[model samples]
Target: MTSSIPSAVTVPSNNVVPSTSTTTEPSTSAEPVAVAVEDSSNLDNDLLDILGIDPTTDKKYGKDLHKDLSVRLQHWTTVGLDKDLKKELKDRYLTPGNCKLIDPPILNAEMKAAISDINVKRDKAIEAKQKVLTSAIVCLGEAITLLLPSKDKDTNLIKLLMDAIRIICECQHSD
Candidate 1:
């Protein structure tokens, strides 16, 4: 997520003094301005940048940020945000009592729909598996009867045997 331009501040520098000086140099326009280099607090500044808030201009930005976060935490307590970092960021950028947080309705609805779809698919899979079990049992019974080498094969009883098989299969197939 690269930004078009980086966030940075152009801090005004003060004239620096030399360490070894027997005689103080007279204040003149000929001397070049010397600024002390200091490390910027990147994390704090970044959080402010993300929230579209500037900390330097506003005196109450830190306090406002804290208050806003506290109110948000009271309302939506399920984000599970990093405690220290969240507070730090909030303190840096949030305006006091700001109520601009986006609601999670969309996410919640999508999750519910996904759960419903999964349940429906699971039910269909179970039904299909039950059908396969019954089909296998019926096929096995038919194969065994057909392979029987008995000479006194009661052809008339075959009808009754088939009806019994059907009943057995129906019972086994019942979910």
Candidate 2:
């Protein structure tokens, strides 16, 4: 006797069988999956600018900037910044000492007084520089205008004119 199997198998439409094998383990590919990461470095730069940090070759100043940034980040975080900002700051700067720094609030009266004193000193220095520059410009302009056309041929007057011209050229070049 010869036996043969059917070419196709069919099941009742209402009695379908589920697949016997199922995947239970997560993927283990070595390639890194892409994720959207929030950039906190730009926030660091903005904080530095807001705190009036100047570019310096001194390592001490760099340390000071880092300390100031850390303190400010802690203070702002405690004072209820936007949720996203707070998260970014915490991710970037939160530390045991940073938490303590904000406890007394950096914006207190003593800090305010110190900042005001620094501002006054800076303004005075700027005023002094401006006065010196203005005097120099006025002196050069007056000397140039006072020279007679006949004196233009004189070597001494020509030297003085050249000196004034040099000052003007230096200022332009500096700008």
Candidate 3:
């Protein structure tokens, strides 16, 4: 029984060749599982599957997966796994959103102001346009003219438009 027991050292199997590996399990304790190195591209699909994200939709696949996964992993306090593998996973998959590398401002007041200003300007323009549309009433493709800055009825673009409108209106009425 003692002779049957293999040592902790990995001995070559019966058909041993120089480059070929035929390592036997460590007989003393639980055999250390030999995990194969997976191709990163394949693992990316697996990670996306785990995250319930569609691969096809993420056109820039690697960057997209890294960004999304890193965000999700922030709240994950505990993960039980091998130390080296955990480090490797963190280093490889959760890279782009690495909080350590780029300290991003969390949507501060300046950003808010810029965004709000654009929205306000857009709204103002839209409101102005709506007023033009509502008040003008398109009277046979004619918008009612507004007064110019100098109140120049003789040489104003608005008066010219109004004149064009009057001519068009007259033609429409005559027809």
Best-fitting candidate, measured by lDDT? 1
Residue 17, candidate 3: alpha-carbon lDDT: 23
By TM-score, the better pick of 1 and 3 is: 1
lDDT of 3 at 122: 67
Q: Estimate the TM-score of every prediction.
A: 0.22, 0.25, 0.16
**Pairs of residues clashing in candidate 1:** none
lDDT of 2 at 23: 38
Off by over 4 Å in 1: 1-115, 144-150, 154-164
Error of 3 at 2 (Å): 99
> 1-175, model 2: which lDDT tens digit per residue?
1112233233332332331224333324442222233343546877767867455633453234477788887886588467685455445433234223222112446655767777756656654444333444444544555665553456687576768757744653343
**CA lDDT of 21 in candidate 2?**
21
Better of 1 and 3 by lDDT: 1
Best by TM-score: 2
Clashes of each: 0, 0, 0
Which of 1 and 2 is the better model by TM-score? 2
lDDT of model 1 at position 25: 53
